[model samples]
Target chain A: MTEKIVIGLDGTDTGERALAFAKDLASKIDACELLAVYVIEWSPFTFQTAEENERRHNRREEEINLAMSRIVDPAVEGLKAAGFKATGLVRHGDVAETLNKLTVENGGTQIIVGRASSDGFAKRIFGSSTQNLVMHADVPVTVVA
Target chain B: MKNFVKFGLTAAAVTVMSSPLAAQETPGIDERVNEAFAAVTGPFVSLIFAPFPGTEFPWIVMWLVVAATVFTIYFGFVQFRFFKHAIHLVKGDYADPNDAGEVSHFQALTTALSGTVGLGNIAGVAVAVGIGGPGATFWMILAGLLGMASKFTECTLGVKYRNEYPDGTVSGGPMYYISKGFKELGIPGGGFLAILFSIFCILGALGGGNMFQANQAHAQISGIVGDYPGWITGIIFAVVVFAVIVGGIKSIANVTEKVVPFMGILYVGAALVILIVNYDMIGWAFSQIFVGAFTGLGVAGGFVGALIQGFKRAAFSNEAGVGSAAIAHSAVKTKEPITEGFVSLLEPLIDTVVICTMTALVIVISQQLIVDPATGNYLLNEAGTAISTVDGNTGVSLTSAAFGASISWFPYVLAVAVVLFAFSTMISWSYYGLKAWTYLFGEGKTSELTFKIIFCVFIVIGAAASLGPVIDFSDAAIFAMAVVNIFCLYFLMRVVKKELSSYATRLDAGEIKRFSH
Candidate 1:
């Protein structure tokens, strides 16, 4: 079985690019699955009621589902439409922690991310979290600019 | 458009020439750095204790770390208790848009972060990791967390002691806090302490905050741009910084308030993408940092013992007691002193906890560590010797190379980030130094103009020169501020307690509410 390719999305513009790349790669590989993972962060203070909290949780889940539907599902559906196997996965926690965890849990072999075109002063004091992960990830990380 | 075209053309040329250039290259970059560092690493390793003094231990770092810790403990870890409140202060429950201050809590926070978060996070960590090891990250985080308390103390004092000009512009910082806050506390030594801190702040403004920031940036740009001496960086930076800084704090803050957030989001967002793509490495990163903190292999045979590397870096990262953040915090618009203190908590959280953590993790897990650890002893590219000192580029380049190992094109990403980080920091520090300059040199036209001229000139020198000596003195001055400021906090901290208790009472009464949804 060919390995799977996963594209992690944080609902940013670059994430959309990563999703497209993952879908194309899934098709190029003889046998591959595409998994979409999202990590949801919830502050313990925000929810005062269980019923309300349940509604909120469900709302967040739906939001992730919709995002997946837009960014990942279209790509996944496109792969399927092209006769390839692809899936979606989403989780929740701190961004770095969640993404790292999801990549390990999912059977993802190679992961893809994005970089920026402008390398101005903004990139300096504040580093690119995606770039940091790609640099240090144990697995093969392909960064798509 | 021309530069863009030129950049593209040049990039292509470098790629095409990489092989031939490598084969026929004659090296001239044999300038040595960290000489004191080398002395410490060799015969001085035992009695001298640390791997290097200023490069590693430096009395300034020692003082800053000590003060930050003392403030954290004395304040009863208030940084944690008031974390939410700090968030709200920026949300501005009490923020009057009609206030006389130059910026709001959020703008103030961003401006200050621009100053505190600079090349230090990148190269400073690299240096600490180079000398101290991965363990340095553990300390850096600890320092950043505790540094929040120090930040709180200084910022509260900043608001407590700030001044308003006749025309209604704001002038504040550690000078006001020390000279003024101390007097309000009925301390006899208030004037002296304020003056001392002002001196330190002035030194810090010029050295660490301004010059050091510009110096490292110049090194990085020149480092990557190739064949160009660092001076070219100085020339460009001098022009840009001089033009902007001459406009004073209003101009500086206006640009920073916008620039800081966008850059912060951009950099952190990029780091997130990298982490997600390389998610598996996260576990190993945590393991190494957690373990490295306990072992001495990171720094290897330091008299101070294990994890000093971590402490040194942490101390550098958060800059809790250094008093630089206070200058920015002083400008916050509020009558209630504690409001700005709450907002100040985010400094270490963003600069130290979030940003520094990401950089540390990246460096730790990079394949480069597979080759050398602790930013330990430089390896000469040609002869492969373990030299104590390296070319200036080694500090930042080490980090870039580690990042590039995973993302082949990541060096450019980091380079862009490095330049921005340095640029924002330079601007922020410029404000800090200006405040100090005005404090010492009588806030007149000539004082402002003269200080500015020198500051701009330093920028060029910083960019063009080798960073070794420039950074050393600047680093020293920053530490000195921490020493003086922490002493005042120790004596006058009861005032902070009263303020905190009163604020807590209001919070309990539900008088303090979030500003908006």
Candidate 2:
């Protein structure tokens, strides 16, 4: 039976590095299915205008497309080209929360994600998803530096 | 989460109750603030809203009326023709599952509606009716109908020239369109107009959107709970507003979208119930409106006063030509900009024609004001306006009196509605002000934060201060925005015309396909 591994992709070089490390680990394991998941951190609890709410469905679709094209696709392609079986998902939610749910749904045994990609002021003020996943994730989480 | 919010609110209520009972007596500061504001705004108010020679009409009112009339002719009355399509678009019939915008046609319209549909529909309408007589209702509807065309034109340009950032966010409104559209047409001074509009928007946002809402909310609260220091209500409002705004733009939109709809339904539903209950009087009330509109029904300002007041209130309430709706509409997701424009035209119609008229009908049907049976004219005070139901009065108090007359318990419900309406308007205007602020100062964390902090401070000031100067300045700022925005619209309207024509042609050819999903 293949061991399912969930990898978070953020459309950054750091994300690519995490995927590469995950790919290496999957090869070491006899049978493994790589699940590349990209989350477009959306908060249902957050405020929105009537306009934003009306277009919420369409915006959700766009966000998914944004995640798939900009983050998940490249990671999936890289894994597939490296001769591994892989699947991709684009979701709208809190990044850490969504990734954990995706892992449980996909029956993933472990999660691999990159370190915080940006050291910008915003990220500093609002902590990174990697830290959140590490603390709250049900499964084992590997943070690639 | 829900329990937490409930608990938090209970705590807040407790704090408000336990904290103060002594300050209401010394309203001296409030008086001084009012006087100071009155002084500052006094001259500008007269200058900006000066009546035209030989008429009671303000020149600013003429500016909007002329623009609305012109757009109506130029677009060949697109408001009527595309009215059906606009409704369809709002229903999400024409929306592609994969559109490029942030909000839907309906959401944009509703969001903008929340901003315009607030105090104006309630308090402003009462003011207009109280002064212009029942006849003002007729002129208001006319202005609203014509204003639809103006809304359509500006909103179309808003989407057409909107700046879509790489992060999938959008910046738009008169600022973007005036600058970008003019540049496209090889017209200079677009930058000048853009800056001017941004300045007015920021000022308007601070004054009308922030202070006025806070002041009104404080008044409502004081009416319910014996007066506290206005600053207390101001501080509370400022704190909540700050929290919501800090959560970002999505948070502001989310709250307004929900609260505005609920409040609108509550207020309008109450009005409908009153109207239905007084079915027999509805016809008589409307006849008064019609008669009063034409002959002024012996009210002061005669026929023209009613017309001017009605038009002014409608323009203020719906904001059709003020161009602020364009900012909200620009966020709508659509491949064709004109579709959003079509959707936007309904804003004024709903806000002014439907909602304002509902308010007017209720006020008229209440029989609270003294009316002469022989001439159907309201008994006027020395100043020549319909006498208030309450002594020394005007604004929402009069509306409250009317509603309270019909339903004894309604004043309590109305106080709640007033607070919610004021809150929603403040949050929405915060966004409008923020956008204009960013346009001038540039977008960054510090810049954004600075504007927001300033906004929060103004909320406190608005709540604490007297209504005179704060409201006057805000009114002037808002009208000033219209002055700059409408001026630019006149020049860039040809571009809007071209876009509308092309969009219409495409619609006729069935080239714009509706996505089933």
Candidate 3:
């Protein structure tokens, strides 16, 4: 009967903070089940090829796994250690849509992730993928710095 | 007279009625590009060679080839030994495809391959073989082999020093390793070298990756769209590329995963069809490759001199020790850096071994006998600049010519493929440069934005302006990066060796499990 929160994590530093806080909130509330989610970015390239793209995908998965292991795993483990229920999910499609899907999937109340992380490149000319995700995630969104 | 007019009108009408065919016949663009390359790269050929002046030091690549060949023998041709394993890696036996990291191994290879796999394989090898002859392919294969070790070392270091953010994002490459590795060595200039590497990377991205890519794309677009001013084509490409690049690595990965594969198949398929139809010529073409490599049949000078040209072309195309491919390999997602390193070894094989050979074979098979394989080069009659091709011609137009000979529709298809390949390559290189940029400068938003914007803008310049000096400077910067990067790799080969052995043991002991999901 507790209000469970669905948090969106795209694996940015800010997302890390949000996930950490969400785990704590879930442990305290006992009513909440934490959903750790990620959205895979797709473009024309992913849509176009079959086996040729797999070579790069494998390399990417290795890095992505390492990343999830570092951030989501610890938080997920921490919540479990405290006897709180936590489920981790990775979604492909647009970041925003996937995060929205997770909210409905979990009957969740909140989405948490990083704000526009400062890219050490050109500014004003670009927006972070996380920023794009935050702008569209329909649930009450929290961007942890 | 009335009958003649009717025939002329009918002919004109027929041409106008053909939509795609009409759109594809823009040889004018090829002519212009050929002229432009001659004006710039042609004149500088001797100059670029004059300064460092030794067939000796700067060309450590030659020795690297020797080293790689020796290592391959010592390890019992590990490239062949692990061939099956590499194939499995590509199959994602251990991959979940949806896993984190910016791209798939295949996509990463293509993305990296795209960056390394441009005209260098096509035009570069052509020039090398033209000047150096078939002996160049021998050296090229040799260099590529040695390049495997360098690729292993750099990619392993790339992952070893890589940073994974709390958001599950990763940032890595030579810049990270060069700086991090130096820090571990207690070297003072580590920071400076890292930044320098970054600057070189940015310059390369803009010039070689961005501008050059855009320039080639514009050439192709214009080929398809005659009278479409080069600048307009450049702007459109720049905007689209900007849109993708602004989204960062995932966006790049997302695009490349598809683009790289599509283009590779299209290119390879086109070449294969050409080779099949001309299957009879395969015998003679390869005969030239072996015979020209040693006897220097058509070359003016001795056999050794002609052989050197082949080596030069091979080096230019495969880029065995250049370290650019390492930048791509560093982005892989595995916990074991060596897995990616092993995967990294495939770049030269795919790029040089499979693709480059296809490119060469296409040209050699199609070329007229007057185009000598021993020194298969000549001056563009109008441009008066020395040019080379597998057939021993100078222009990318020659690539199209071969395509045209096999399939009636092939020239157009190949043109589109070349443009896409060049564009994807440039865009991918942009990321490599950006990582380096961030490495040198503080991770500030303004600095980041400025570089990307500048990089985007160069697409227009590359398309519209003179490529002569720009390409030279860019080539120098890229090759210069190899000098700096390889120096680090040589000193730090121990780390790569340790990782390689450890991973080998893991594989042997079944510590590394094959993937099910």
Candidate 4:
């Protein structure tokens, strides 16, 4: 049976480190696949005007396209060029939940993400995605420093 | 900077045009302008408000009531049956994460609510109770309840018949549904009714949506500051409004969307405070509303007058059956159009049954209306308007006085809220009017700009004009929308019924997915 690892990408240097760690871990094991996922943070609770609401569908589409092109695509391409089996996914939702859901659906054995250095006030009040994933993931969550 | 320069130039031009009237002392330019407007619009206004033959009630009010009743019965009280589901939809419990669009049920409902819950709730309720007596409140609540079904019907059609462009933007309203639904049914004259509905929507957007908001906003501001030329207020409002709509200032529109909802909560919170403080009078106020609803409490025209005022204000406030809210709700992201229909029923409940009732209760509890001890009827001045304790203050002023009597600082907060409400309503209506404009003239940059400019100019006119002609014309234009919209709704309600039963069967069969616990 192939071991599947889900790597969360933020299009940042920290995220690249997490990818490198996940690739290193996958190489030691035969028949391993990497699933790169990018989640755009969105909340349905935000209020919008009529005009804004009208344009929101298009805006969401634009956000998804930008994420796939700029973040998920590059990571997946690099993994493929390195002769590793990899695929990319982009979605709009809370970051931790989307990543966890992707892992479960894809039968990923482990989840990997980078530790973001900035712990802002909001993140403290509402735990960071990494913190949430570490606490709640069904599979083991590997946090790369 | 370019937008600012353009806005500054327009404001300067408007100020220059209005200065002559401000400088002149003869009858004042405000009165002269109002008189000219009244003269032109008088016949149309009278025709719209014309009483039914051998009856004092305006046929338009009855038309709305009857349509609401029909929809309520036809849908088997869909508003009541699915009301709990509506709340769940808004809470996103039934939301599919993979829905094609981005707008949630909550956002759609809030956007529609913001448009309907404006000056109509603040001032319109005062006018209802003031003229129709406390009994009007009873009828107003009933109209709100029945109107929910009308919203469900129109909004279902709004989503089902919506025109989704290749670019992903959608447009839907009475015009789209009337034409498309009628064509589907092989009905003739759908084209004519669609065109007529679009025309009425544009006029209603300009009159009730634009001018009435501007006029009442000026009234509130002038009440706070000392009396000044209304054109001054008009020009300032016109400039800000012009900047948002014409100049494409999304920042202003964004701020307004966020702030207005907060203000709505603040206004309601203050009303709750006042209601709690006047807890002792709550029973008396409700009893007055009940008795006045039946007896008219000696109000002129008795029970019929209360019924007329209640129906008229509820239609104006909740905008159910008016077809404007359908436009707002149509953009919601849902494959099942009936889901949006269910969500929309909550609009009238919030706008009229809850918020408007709060305003009415506050006015009654404040003891603002002077009741003659001998006759038990409200004291009427020479002009026959009810003499309130606040020197016959009407509209927002009367409402402000009622709140102020309980919370002294409330009137100040209310003044700010009123201005914000006016600005937000104007912005929303500009979009509705522009939709109708584009529907008629075809979509293009120049056509859009022309309508925006005309809309801004009307804001100035709305602010400058007196209450009489502005209110009359506004009422006429809005009811005119109901005339076309409700007629089409009768034809399209079966479509909604089919959708509702399909949705219900799916839910009962466990086909509908619930995303959250």
Output the number of the lDDT-best candidate: 4
- TM-scores for candidates 1 onward, in order: 0.66, 0.77, 0.67, 0.96
Q: Residue by residue across A12-112, what tens digits does model 4's lDDT show?
A: 88799999999999889899999999888887777788998888888989988999999999999999998899999988888898889889988999999
- Report the lDDT tens digits of candidate 1 across residue range B1-517: 8667545543443343233224334432213223432332243223313334455444545666677778778777888887877776766555542231124577667656767777777777776665555666787788788788888888888778777655445667777877776677677887777778887776676666666676677656655676565444655666566655553324543454455557667666766777787799888778666666666343443423225555555555566777777777665556688888888988888888898777777776763543345563323234321113333224677677666666787777677777767767766676677777777777786687677666665565555445556655655566667778887888778888899889889889978654344
Model 4 residue runs over 4 Å out of place are A117-119, B1-27
Q: How well is candidate 4 docked (DockQ)?
A: 0.67
The candidates' DockQ values read: 0.01, 0.11, 0.09, 0.67
Ten residues in a row with the worst lDDT in model 1 chain B?
B384-393
Candidate 3: C-alpha lDDT: 0.62
lDDT of each: 0.64, 0.81, 0.62, 0.88
Candidate 3 chain A, poorest ten consecutive residues by summed lDDT: A43-52
Q: Would candidate 4 be rated incorrect, acceptable, medium or high by CAPRI criteria?
A: medium
What docking grade applies to model 1? incorrect
Worst 10 residues of 3 chain B by lDDT: B378-387
Cα lDDT of candidate 4 equals: 0.88
Superposition error at B288 for model 3 (Å): 0.9
Task: Fill in the DockQ of model 2.
Answer: 0.11
Name the lDDT of candidate 1. Answer: 0.64
**Model 4 lDDT at residue B208:** 87
